[model samples]
Target: MDSWVDGQPADSLSLKDRGLAYGDGLFETIAVHDGQPVLLDRHLVRLADGCLRLAIAADIQLVRQELLSYAAAMGEGVLKLILTRGDGLRGYAPDPTAPGRRILQGNPAAAYPAVNAEQGIRLFPCSTRLSHQPLLAGLKHLNRLEQVLARAEWQDSEHAEGLMLDQAGRVIEGVFSNLFLLRDGVLLTPDLKRCGVAGVMRAEILFQAESLAIPTQIADISLEQLQWADEVFVCNSVYGVWPVRAYAALSWPVGPLTRKLQTIARALLDA
Candidate 1:
C-alpha cells in the first residue's frame, strides 16, 4: 500500500538505478486530500523544469495520470513522487538508453497539533549552511545530504523545525520547508537563484499575495532582517503553513499576515 515502482507494485528499486548511484533524479512531495493532489499542475510544472535541466526524458502525461491514480487509491495522504534516470551501466556516465523510472509512495496525512497552526512553532538555527550552486538552485533533486546533515543538528522536541542559512549567513530556508518573512506589511522570501528548493506551496502563496495586493519580494534575507520581522512562516505542500513563534532568542506572536495567507493556502489545498 505504501509504494509502486514504474506503475507496478514493488518495494525495491534496481541497485544500478542512477538515482541511488549518483542522486541523478528529481522529486516532489505532494499533499493529497479527498482524492485530489493539491497544486498538481504546479508540481508537474516544476517536475518538467527539473527534467529539462537534467536532460532526462519526461513522460509528463504518464507521470500526471499515475500520480492522480496513486493519490485516488490512497484516498487522502502524502505522496512522494520520485523520477529517476532509471538503471544504468556501472560507471559515472549516464546510460543513453535509460527510460526514466517513476516511484510513488504514500504516507498518512500528518496531524500537526492544533496549537502549532493556531499559535506557532519553535525553530532551531542549524549550523549547517547550504552550499551555493546557482545552476542547481530551486530543483528538488535527490541530493539531500545537506538537509539531512542540517536536520541532524538537533534532537529536541521543543524545536519543531530547523532554520538553515546559506554560506553567506543569509537565511535560505527551513530544513524541509520554505520560509517567508513579513516585514513592514510586506511578504518576502529568500531568493532561490543561488540555492534552496523553490517549494510548491511557496509558489502558491506568492500568487495569492499578488491577487490580494499584499506586496511580496524575493531577495537575499539576513538573520537580522528576520529577527526584526513582524511575522515569519514556513511552508511546504504537505504541511501547508506554520508560523514561527520563536527562533533562537527572538519571539514573535502569530500575526495577521501569516493567518491571511494560511486561509488562502488551505482553500487552495482543498480547491
Candidate 2:
C-alpha cells in the first residue's frame, strides 16, 4: 500500500522536514484488525500527550480521521503514524506555531516465532544503556538512537529480545518492549519516570491487572530484583506479551500469572 503524507498519497517528504533534520516528532505503531485500529484511543491519547509535551501544533481530529481512513484501507496490518513539526530552518529553536506534518505508513502484521510466546524467550543482556531524560521519558518520541544502538548489540536468533538498563544500572525495559515481573503475587514493572518508553501495551496491562484485582507496583528495578522474580515477561502493543525465560544466567519459568495475563493480552490483540 502507498503511504500518505498529511491526507494525500505521497512517497516523499520535504528535505527540510524537522523530523528528518532534528528528529523533532512523535510516532505511534498501531495494530489494525478487521479494518479497525486496535487501541486507537490509547494510541491517540499518547500522541496528543507527546504533542503537548513537545509543543508541536498538531490537528488531533484530522489525525484521527486520517488514521481511520488509512486503517480501513489497510484492513489487516500495522499502521505507523508519524507527526513531525513540519519543515524548519537550520537551528535548534523551533517555530511554536508550525502545524505538524502527518505521515502514515502501512505494513503487514509483525512476524515472530510462535515459540517466543508459547515456550518463552531468551533475553540478551544489552551492553547499551538508556540515558536519563525525565522530560522525554515516556513519550514515544522520534529520537530513538539509544534503542537503535541497543538493538544493534544483538544479531543472532538465539535471543528473541534484549534487556536494557539505565546508566545507573537499574533495569528499565527491552530494546523495543516494556517488561514486567511477578514476585510474591505482586506484579512489578520498572518506573519510567527517569527514562524508557511508556508503551501502550504496558499501560493496558496495568489497567487489566487493576481490573483483575492483581496488585501491581511501578518502581526502580535492580538486577538483584530481577534475579528474585518468580516470573518475568515483556510486552509491546504489537507482539502482545512474551514470557522471559532467561536473561544472561538468571532464569525464570512462565508462571501461572504470566500465562493468565498472556491470555488476556492475546485476546486484546486478536480482537
Q: Root-mean-square deviation of each candidate, in angstroms?
A: 1.2, 0.7
Candidate 1 Cα errors over 4 Å, as ranges: none
lDDT of 2 by residue, 118-163 (tens): 9999999999999999999998999999999999998999999999
Clashes of each: 0, 0
Please provide, for model 1 over 184-205, each residue's C-alpha lDDT reduced to its tens digit, 9 standing for 90 to 100: 9899999999899999999999
Residue 149, candidate 2: Cα error in Å is 0.8
For each candidate in turn, the TM-score is 0.97, 0.99
The TM-score that candidate 2 achieves is 0.99
Q: Estimate the TM-score for candidate 1.
A: 0.97
Query: How many backbone overlaps does candidate 1 show?
Result: 0
Candidate 1 lDDT score relative to the true structure: 0.91
The candidate maximizing lDDT is 2
